[model samples]
Target: MKTLGRVLTAMITPFHADGSVDFDGAVALANHLLDNGSDGIVVCGTTGESPTIANEDKLTLFRRIVDVCGDKGSIIANTGSNDTLRSVEFTKQAAATGVDAVMAVVPYYNKPNQKGLYAHFKAIAEATTLPIIVYNVPGRTGGKIIPATIEQLHRDFPNIAAVKEASGDVNVASEIYRRIPTDFMIYSGDDGLTLPILAVGGCGIISVAAHVVGKDLNEMIQAFERGEVTKAREIHARLLPIFDAMFVTTNPIPVKYAVRRLGLPAGPFHLPMCEPSEEEAAVIDAALKMIK
Candidate 1:
């Protein structure tokens, strides 16, 4: 199985002023991230506003980003959703795009039981030859894929290589670490919990804060790996403000604003997702001042 690297940015989808997907901007952003500290890019995940992007646009992004950054670093496509059949078909399509891997989020809204969750991921894993990262963010998904379920899936599918544990509960992550094989990876799906998750044997993070602070985040992870616990803690403390800022408003809103402020190719947000409020922008600005 292939490793998708330690720090994967859950990248945002850049847009044109007219609300169209900005393919050129995406290529630029992908290169920018790889040049910084991102080991891979997870395009069209929650941070990318996947709910709003069209399927054809997502496929285009998967192909285009892979073409541009495939050799430079990993390019992971988010092809999973609440629907099983659609996820299976999309995972196949995304795999054909030459992306290094695919991420399937825990099915949301319908709140499937553990058995259903197992079946859901089992079908996705069986569909493709690419490595699979099972995303488990119960806060958004309205349900949780307990550790036993995750362990079962990992045991059943060799291709189900990792789980992005975003439950925000360290005990849960610790339990998962104790249950799974050491070779099976666990990633922090939440930026704020990266270090704690790492302490409990998480591999790295599928991060949002990485857009502005990738180098610093990577340094922290490396510091931990080298047993420089003090240095890692210091970096995490310094980054806490930026981490807090990114979520001052709902996810991609503040993060998209931060990316635009950096003079990158990030553009306007689609409907239902809009610009940050003035108060939220102020908080984000205060936090961004800490970068560099």
Candidate 2:
């Protein structure tokens, strides 16, 4: 299985002022991320405001990012949704776009039981030959996929390659590490828990903060892996404020603003996902200054 490197950014979608998908801007941003520190980009994820992006635009964005950055880094498209059939069909389409892999977030709102979750993912896993990253973010999904279910999926499907464990509980990550095979990767879905999860054998992070502090984040990960514990801890401590600020007002809001502040391509947000308030933008500004 090809690992989607150590620091994958759950990238923000760049939009035109008219609220149209900025295809050219997205290409620029993907290259910018690759040029910086991201090993890959997870387009159309939560930070990318997947909920608001149209399906056609999403496919286009996936293809565009892959076209520009596929050779430079991994491009993992966010193709999952709360609907199983829809997710399966979309995953198949996303796979056709040449992404390195596809991530299926745990079904949100319509909380599914373990059996249902298993079946839902099974259908998606069966639909594609590409690697699948099972995204388990309970805070947004309204339910969590237990380690047992993940283990079962890993065992049953070779393509069900990894889990983005963002439940915010280190014990959950530890349990997942204990159950899954060594080859089955686990990624920190929460930026705050990256080091703790790594201590428990996680492979890397699917991060939001990497948009601003990609180089520093990558340095921290490399420091830990190189036995520079103190150095890693120092970097993590310095980045904690930025991590908190990213969530100061729901993800992407602070991150999008931070990116634009850097004079990057991040444009205005789509409906229901507007820009940060004055107070929130101040917090994000302070946090961005922390990046060294």
- The lDDT values for all models are 0.92, 0.91
TM-score of each: 0.98, 0.98
Q: TM-score for candidate 2, please give it.
A: 0.98
* lDDT for position 127 in model 1: 97
State each model's C-alpha RMSD to the native: 1.1, 1.1
Candidate 1 lDDT over residue span 196-279, tens digit each = 999998889999999999999999999999999999999999999999999998999999999999999999999899999899
Q: List the candidate 1 regions with Cα displacement exceeding 4 Å.
A: none
List candidate 2 segments past 4 Å from native.
none
Give the per-residue lDDT of model 2 (tens digit) for 1-292: 2478999999999999999999999999999998899999999999999999999999999998888789999999998999999999999999999999999999999999999999999999999998899999998889989999999998999799988998899998899889974888899999999999989988899999998888889999999999999999999998899899999998878999998999999999998988788999899888877774
Which 10-residue window of candidate 1 scores lowest in summed lDDT? 1-10
For candidate 2, give the lDDT.
0.91
RMSD of 2: 1.1
Candidate 1, position 205, lDDT = 92
